[model samples]
Target: MERAISASDANQRFSELLREVAEGESFTVMSRGRAVARVLPVDRAREQRSIQHLLKFVAALPVRHAGNWSRDELYE
Candidate 1:
């Protein structure tokens, strides 16, 4: 379950909140008593894998000579 914290409480207890999130706990920051933002641990492995996949996709594309064509030409 996500922990909820009021805006004022979050501001006052920022450090503690961060500690909880760093430990893989999720939080919902409330503004005007309504949930507005979320804090959670970074999924570094997943993020890195996604970045690597994107880079591979980009690298695999054929390089165009100067003034060759627009991106649409490559996909179409």
Candidate 2:
């Protein structure tokens, strides 16, 4: 779960929060005891999404039969 940060604290330490978020730490900014916004690592999110999409694409690909080869060639 992402950690919660009150609006005031977020405002007071915006620079530090941004640095931490950029380093892959996520946070939910709260207001009046409720979540109002979120902070996340953009690069990490994009990389994770790209990797997941690539994995799904690879998984859906059809497997090809292996060609017959001599025992020595197979071992090599």
Candidate 3:
């Protein structure tokens, strides 16, 4: 659940908010009853998961052995 906090209050307790965010807590900053911003932890695990998925995708691609053609032959 996202906690609602006023902009001014959020500014006053930014440090405490950061601590909560680090612990997986999310907050929505409101301005005049409208949500203006969100404070959440960086999704480091999601990034790692994406990289792992990409590695698996690459590994599944067909492998090709090195060809004997000279590098300059194609340009000649």
**Cα lDDT computed for each candidate against the true fold:** 0.91, 0.93, 0.95
Candidate 1 local lDDT, residue 66:
80
lDDT of 1 by residue, 1-76 (tens): 6888898998999999999888889889999878899988999999999999999999999987787688999799
Q: Estimate each model's TM-score.
A: 0.70, 0.55, 0.60
**After superposition, which runs of candidate 2 have C-alpha atoms over 4 Å from their true positions?**
44-76
Clashing pairs in 1: none
Candidate 2 local accuracy as lDDT?
Answer: 0.93
Candidate 3 residue-wise lDDT, 1-76, digit = tens: 7899999999999999999999999999999999999998889999999999999999999999777788798679
The better-scoring model by TM-score among 2 and 3 is: 3
Query: Highest lDDT, which number?
Result: 3
How well does candidate 1 score on lDDT at residue 35? 89
Q: What TM value does model 2 have?
A: 0.55
Q: What TM-score quantifies how close candidate 3 is to the native fold?
A: 0.60
